[model samples]
Target chain A: MNVKDKYYQEVLRFWKDLTPNQRELVDHSIIKKHFNKGEAMRSSSDQCSGLFLIESGQVRAYIISENGKEITLYRLFDRDVCIFSASCIMKNISFDIFIETEKETTAYLIPTSIFDKLSKESMAVQVFANELMASRFSDVMWIMEQTLFMTLDKRLAIFLLEQSNIEESDTIKITHEKIANHLGSAREVITRMLKYFQEEGIISLSRGTIHIVNRKRLEQLTLY
Target chain B: MNVKDKYYQEVLRFWKDLTPNQRELVDHSIIKKHFNKGEAMRSSSDQCSGLFLIESGQVRAYIISENGKEITLYRLFDRDVCIFSASCIMKNISFDIFIETEKETTAYLIPTSIFDKLSKESMAVQVFANELMASRFSDVMWIMEQTLFMTLDKRLAIFLLEQSNIEESDTIKITHEKIANHLGSAREVITRMLKYFQEEGIISLSRGTIHIVNRKRLEQLTLY
Candidate 1:
């Protein structure tokens, strides 16, 4: 089947209650796009791209501080939706976010004008859009809560475990700098913490990878 | 005029395009409620309280950690709309937020059932609701960015400047514990920082208030 047909079966299936007119608008405006890994797709300061419904692969949405520190807001995987890419259509959303393809990603993009039109004219589109926005808000709030309340060690522990789960391996092929960027910490701090963890027999670090020596200990660090 | 009519003129005036049926639904189900200062209006673990359209006074929305540390997400003032209070209606929103009256607050609440019905049936209601949600998301994201990227001194300086602007006075009638809660810091840390600020001749601290001694220096600190 063609990409549009595939999109219709995958993304449009969620909006089964949409009117014929609304469906027509989506069909006429939707475009399928591909990006290579590490390609920058959108930035908060750039023009708005409409909603993205991921068909495959992965994307990381993040924000860069004035000082050039970056932190991940969230990640989008297969079948996930990114509404912030089209944030320009929302009047009150002032902050900008950056989106980059973490892997070779394919997604269906609904242009901003079409999304703005449908969100105003169709209740189904509105509900879908609002739910996506609310869910994203919850995620951003969770990141904020962790930053505000949790110590660096706990957050790093949680991040390592999460990375292990995502990569489905006890050894994570990630650099200390990369981990620092994700956790919004300095590289030296992360390195020091990792060394301390190594001494505690919880983890062992190689040149560019970390292998969990005691997964239970790492898990316990997250709890404490 | 009665309270309901006042609410119609004040809050519903912005939603002029709402259909008569939608208007009737809101008008019938809308309730005007008053909250005394310091009253806990809603918690994440409690029942959803629908949407709040502030008529007067102030409300603070915050989240509490497992260890009971509280951090302010955002504040709602006159004419501000809070969509998270009715987050229960949105299926994918899993986080709970707590709302309390920072001052004696008067607000008109749209019942969740009525709001859900109208949002599904009326495009105007959908737009209004979505805009509110998007705006609140922006606020929460701004908070997250501050927590992740900024130093405690910079955030404290910004907070003091913001409080001065809001109160229209250089002397803020707030305690260190309250400031800690708002900035998501410990009382001792806040006290130490306040002492530093006082030593720097930026501010003066009393038993229950902070008086800005040098507004220019405080502003410069935030810029730095």
Candidate 2:
């Protein structure tokens, strides 16, 4: 299939109730592009321009504080559509959120004007957009709950387990600084926690990587 | 004006784009009711049944933790619409968010079935729904950022300033425990912070209220 046909199929699969007009608009307006790992797609100062649909690879959506500390709001993977990342489309959302590629990524970008038009013309598009927005809101809410109620140790443990699962391996290749940035904590704090975990025989930490030695203990740590 | 006309004016003001059919559906399906202070509107196990449009007074939307701790997600005031509080209309959203009255509140409830039908039939309804969802998502995102990146002292100061503005009084008639609950922190933590603020002469604490003494200092605290 051609690029347009490829994106058309993806959009159709994702939102099955799209009317013919919406499908036509989406098929014509989408622009496909590729970004290398670590490339920034959206930044704090830029206006939100459109919806991004990831066909392959991963994207990290995050926010940075005035002091330059960063927190991961959520990650968009294959088949995920991110509308909030581009804030210009919706006037009520004004906060600056940055979206960057986690790896070499290929994605289809649908301009906000076209998406807004489709949303205004198609109920299916509107429903799909609402669901997506609600889903992101729920993710942020979960993060807030974790930050408020759960201790750093529990969060770190859960993060490690989630990373392991996402990577599909017990040995995860990540650094302390990267983990701290993702968790919105200082590097020293994460290093100290990892050291404590190491002393407890829960995980074996090496330079730039961590191996889960006692999965049971690590899992137990996340339970509470 | 009659009760139906009273609700009609409110709905028209909130969703100005509603088509005649959509308006008719809303008018026919809406149920106007009054809720006393501290009454629950939606609970953890209940499915969302419809859209709630606040006419007067205030409503608090929050989540309760497994251990009985509570966190205020957002608040609904006069002219505000809350769709996420009722989860049944949207299938992907499953989080347990409880909506309760902070004061005696009068609201117009449109059943989910009617709202869904209107949404499917009217592009105007769809756009309005999308905007509302996007707005709520933005609120949740702000909360996540505050919880993850902001220090408790900064958060408390910001919260107090916001409350002062909301209530239009420097001497706010709210207890430390209530403030703690709103910020999703322990009462002891808030008390300690409030005592420190008192020592710093930024605020004065009494039996059941906190009086802002130096608003400038409290505002400065939130800058960092």
Q: Which 10-residue window in model 2 chain B sums to the lowest lDDT?
A: B7-16
TM-score for all models, in order of appearance: 0.92, 0.91
Tens-digit per-residue lDDT, A86-159, candidate 1: 88878688888899998899998989998888777667777777778777887887887787788999999999
lDDT of each: 0.85, 0.81
Runs in model 1 deviating more than 4 A are A1-7, A19-25, B1-9
Candidate that scores best on TM-score? 1
Candidate 1 structure quality by residue, lDDT tens digits, B52-113: 88889999999999888998989989988777777777767877788899999998898888
- Any idea what lDDT model 2 has? 0.81
- Which candidate number maximizes DockQ? 1
Q: Whose lDDT is greatest here?
A: 1
lDDT at B11, model 1: 67
